[model samples]
Target: MGLRSHEQLVVCVGVMFLLTVCITAFFFLPSGGADLYFREENTVHVRDAFIREELRRKEQEELRKKAEEAIPIPIPKPEIGAADDAEGRRIFVKQMIKFSWDGYRKYAWGENELRPNSRSGHSSSIFGYGKTGATIIDAIDTLYIVGLKEEYKDAREWISHFDFKEAAKGDLSVFETNIRFTGGLLSAYALTGDKMFLKKAEEVATVLLPAFDTPSGIPYSLIDLQTGRAKTYSWASGKAILSEYGSIQLEFDYLSNLTGNPVFAEKANKIRDVLTSMEKPEGLYPIYISMDNPPRWGQHLFSMGAMADSWYEYLLKQWISTGKTDDRTKREYEEAMFAMEKRMLFKSEPSNLWYFAKMNGNRVEHSFEHLACFCGGMAVLHSMNEPNRTISEHYLTLGKEIGHTCHESYSRSTTGIGPESFQFTSSIEAKTERRQDSYYILRPEVVETWFYLWRATKDEKYRQWAWDHVQNLEKYAKVNFFEPFLNSSPSYFQGAAGYSGIRNVYDSAPEQDDVQQSFLFAELFKYLYLIFSDDSVLSLDQWVFNTEAHPFRIRRP
Candidate 1:
């Protein structure tokens, strides 16, 4: 191009000179830092860049460490207690299970339960849904968990052929199946990291989905595992047990996340949301809920017993399992627990023993059960989360009191085993009345709470209490054919005369029930064993136990 004037020509010549310099620099300059200024030494700049890089690298590493800490990591069981003490208890428990299993193997090998005392072996689907040896399935993970390798391997092999599709109809309780079967398999998978347990769990979940097909997302109380058919009671239209609908969330939600299926969590959350949405007095809902028609208020028959115990349990545990991410459940559980503190908790004036009182329309029912004793453990669990030191100590106190009261119930009995249910009337004679609800059946709640408190406090007294209970159970509940009973030869209960299922804890030689509930093996002895073993194995910090005594590891989100 030609310049218009001498002034423009001079500007063009200046620009050309600058271009020539830049071209020369582009060809000759170093690769990294030759953009703007040049013709100067850059030793300081290079040194500064290296210092900045190192600082940046360190900062990034620090940030990575913080991120990892921010994510919750579950604490695993740390070996606790004196080694000899732990081993002794473990061996005792192992033998107990073996002895109990002897009765089971002979009488109820493939059945859900054993009629230990029956002349000819009687089997029944008590809590487990199938006659395909649900007890074996229920006990399998427990065996593996406690390191009973031989038993674990045997049970695993036997269970490999379990045909889930062929499970019988007309003999299933949905609540029981959810707690025992689904919880068991899920727990086993978590421990073994084995996908087989997960696959079987998914099968059970698929079969049970039909129960939740109800209008309100609440499952029916019972279902046939084979047909996906529900057992309809006259009350089945909208009614469901409080704990049944509410407690399955921990197991089912974990399954959902593990399997990458949202359906499980969706249905479980439906129940949780609906239950908490109601206008409850404090946080306690009625023991029953009608899914189709929700009730706002004025139904106060409350207890932390069989029907409603695990609802509170799952709420707190759900908060934990999700790594404290579920704020809603936390709030719900706290509110409900405060309500129980106000309504259900009763400090006896005469006995001065703190016990949870069942309520009937704002009045004290003056009753608690072996099943309800689990609340003390829940209270101890909640204390760990409470930020306020004062409030936390108060909860711990409450838990210990309830736990102590439960143990007293057993100690007061002749057999030193608590009844299935007991009550302390507010009036004269505040002593526990087993006549209303007697019979131990090897129930595990009192001892279970005792174990929790022992772990939390490391108090030697709790260990002593645990020892006494174990000694009593061994003396009274253990079946010895050598002793012929003096009084009509101990009640041959359930028509089977089985050694398990004690009908009377108030007698020197208590009558034995025929039906040995599967949970005796699954929960009672398992808990006792854990209580005596070091608290590190299946520790409370690292695991959450379903109602059926299945342990699930706490995972970070």
Candidate 2:
């Protein structure tokens, strides 16, 4: 009410000091002083975005977990069952070789009689399918997996009788000795851990490289081993290109790891580069291509069901092992695989399965009457990472269906079926349009398909299927039960009782279990045993082939 001049002056000075401090603080702050405050606000925005990303990742992890845990697959018992399958396969293989040897001995009785070709097991001379160039290679592949010490030495000696160098020079279109001996040599090395096997495998891979000399960078099916020249255009001419190509790469991959050989890696890449350029429109590849004329060969839009699986498998394996690939290659390959998966794997018959097709634009033109052995191979592709679980499951289901139906209808669920220790379950398809005529003679590939599917799904149904098949084999087919299953004692070895030719040997009503079992028999049964035996998939992670002899030694998580 009656402030003195000194009091009023004090209050005014206090207010003035407060205003001065605020002004000084605002002015001396950094140039982006407003932004500095706003930066704190930006964290709110970032937190929101980060939250969203985490949510998405969580969903993905859930999906992965669901995929991993989905369907409750039974772990395979590879170690325990491996010996059994290996033992069975070994017995079968021994019988096969002995039968051939006996035939060889018998041919001595006739004047100038030639033995069946050792490779293909085809001996037209004895009403046999004629010697196939691929037979010996397959046998050797199996032999390496299951051969005993003495057996391996004998195999080496027998193979030594043929001069592979000269045989490689003779014919290019027909199966060459190089691929044959390469498999044989590699198997030998794997079995014996010997240097000679490695040397021979390398030699074969070196000779096989010239096969990729085409303009398209895709390999020719046949190559002059002597001249390194390209040969004719057979259906599988270009298809055989990758097996040798990838096989060599696998060899090189092993060599690089084992011996630290940079040259082997370099050689593998050289072959890989040639094959890489064959990626075609819509990411699909051609079955045949001329090395010199990439554009001309490119026009023929042919894609076989089996060969397509081979291509994807090779690429996926390479990507997984070498990590040399990029996102683009994987994306392209995945797209191609999805496209093929939808067309061939889904819409194809529940009964007959996929027909070989031509990819014209987005559509396919059906060509073949019989399903090739590759449909089973296609089902195995489901083991990859992908979004569409239904697609993979559907194909796997269809494959099982085919196997079951075939077993019931064609083979009559017979056991111990196979010719010459091999099942001649050829791709049963008819030349005629009728279903009855559709039963063509071939080897039993369904057994292989079933085993692989069982491995992937680990469903009890597959195990039951396998169990039933095993029992059926023991029941109907010519099995020498007298030969004990155990391998520990010499008493288990029984004098060979199984015939080499197909079963239905002397019967008017023949079954499918007869004729020939391919080298793939070991692969089939090995997986079957592993699937049923409560083995872990992690055990098989490091294994490439998962065959009878090499049990999965990799540890599981």
Candidate 3:
């Protein structure tokens, strides 16, 4: 019995010794059992706890960064006041007149563009040209004889210098010259007692009227100025903006009004019809289209920029002027604008400055803001006759915000217009890592925005902003290139310049014409300043007109 008990005890002791050996190998061995045992016994729980705390802290930090980067935006409602419709109409007409006159004639106009072909390869002042037409139309429609005289003289001189034969098509100058000189002349004659501006305008109009001969019903971008025939297929839908197509229609209207010919209005309607057929299923207009056929997304490159908005403006204007009140085309145009406002025109930075963009469905393309676009919005607002309280207020705020942001961003000592320099990139999550390319242009757009804001708000800050723009232009952006005729005499100046910047950072080099157009930029602020500073001399008659002749609805949600 004692021997059996000892054997049992020895067996139990052997099992216990094996178990200890196995435990040792598992805890201490670098591979297999030892490593696994060590990890499970000594490190897993403690390491996991530390990791959990670290991850939580990291998450909190990320949240804080996101909060810091967010900028607040205001979405105000537009309010309409007492039968200010008449007053609003007068304000818009006058403002348009003043803006067109002051911005172009006082600063730019015959300055940057010397004698048509003599332009310093950079005289594509779309606003300057477009506004000239606007000035003529406003003067004629409002029956301002004195205004017509100044405008007609400028119109005639502008046309006298240009043959329009060698102008570049697909280039903006062709359209500008055609609109301003051609359309301006016709409108001037139609309104006042001057036939010189009118006769010359008719000749130019006859030259430009053939640009609408494309299969797509859209006008070709480039027309042989001499022959007045279109030759290219660029940005078909881009003309939808009133500024783009408006001058053309206005010209046609001028022709029709003067000659008592309905054919001009008929031609204008053809453009309207063409754009109506090109609307997307969602009503978003493409940035560009083929001048030869129906618009396709393949031809949709560069669709929604500042120029594109002008197309919309003109379309709506056409519908109203032709008594297309119940027209589906007019309604679609209105709807598209609403989409543009909701999706694209937003203040991404704390400054409340508006940015132009392409919308991909519900998303606003908060990529960049161009000068022409800011002006486009202001022009649209003026035309819509919406009370200046909200719509105008928003644009005015945007201008102020943009002015603040631009002064802050381009504060460096650099010459030449910063091509695509004045952009708000806070909305871009990967903006820091992105490179500046074609889309990132720094040009006259920033200062142009300042001009628009200053004009609209009449705030002293805008004048200060304009002064800052001028200081920058004088300090770093000045260029002294001589004209071909007088190489030593320096015959040309650039108000608005090129699309590229130094080292290709975010802008382009300074251009003579582009830089001179900045003078036009200066002229706007100066005029506004003079008007407000010494109101006794300036006439509001030049600025105000009735819009009841062409009434249209201005709605908001």
Kindly give the number of clashing pairs for every candidate.
7, 35, 48
Model 3 stretches astray by more than 4 angstroms: 1-174, 184-193, 225-229, 234-247, 290-307, 313-333, 346-353, 359-365, 372-380, 387-456, 478-557
Sorted on TM-score, highest at the top, how do the candidates line up? 1, 2, 3
Candidate 2 regions with alpha-carbon error over 4 angstroms: 1-137, 147-149, 159-163, 173-180, 226-229, 234-279, 293-301, 304-309, 320-332, 348-378, 381-444, 460-539, 546-557
The 10 consecutive residues of candidate 2 with the worst lDDT sum are: 547-556
Candidate 2 lDDT tens digits, 439-495: 323333545556566666666565555555444443343323122233333333222
Worst 10 residues of 1 by lDDT: 489-498
True-vs-predicted CA distance for residue 239, candidate 2, Å? 11
Candidate lDDT (C-alpha), each = 0.74, 0.44, 0.44
Q: After superposition, how far is residue 20 of candidate 3 from its true place, in Å?
A: 99
TM-score of 2: 0.56
For every candidate in turn, the CA RMSD to the true structure comes to 29.5, 32.2, 24.3
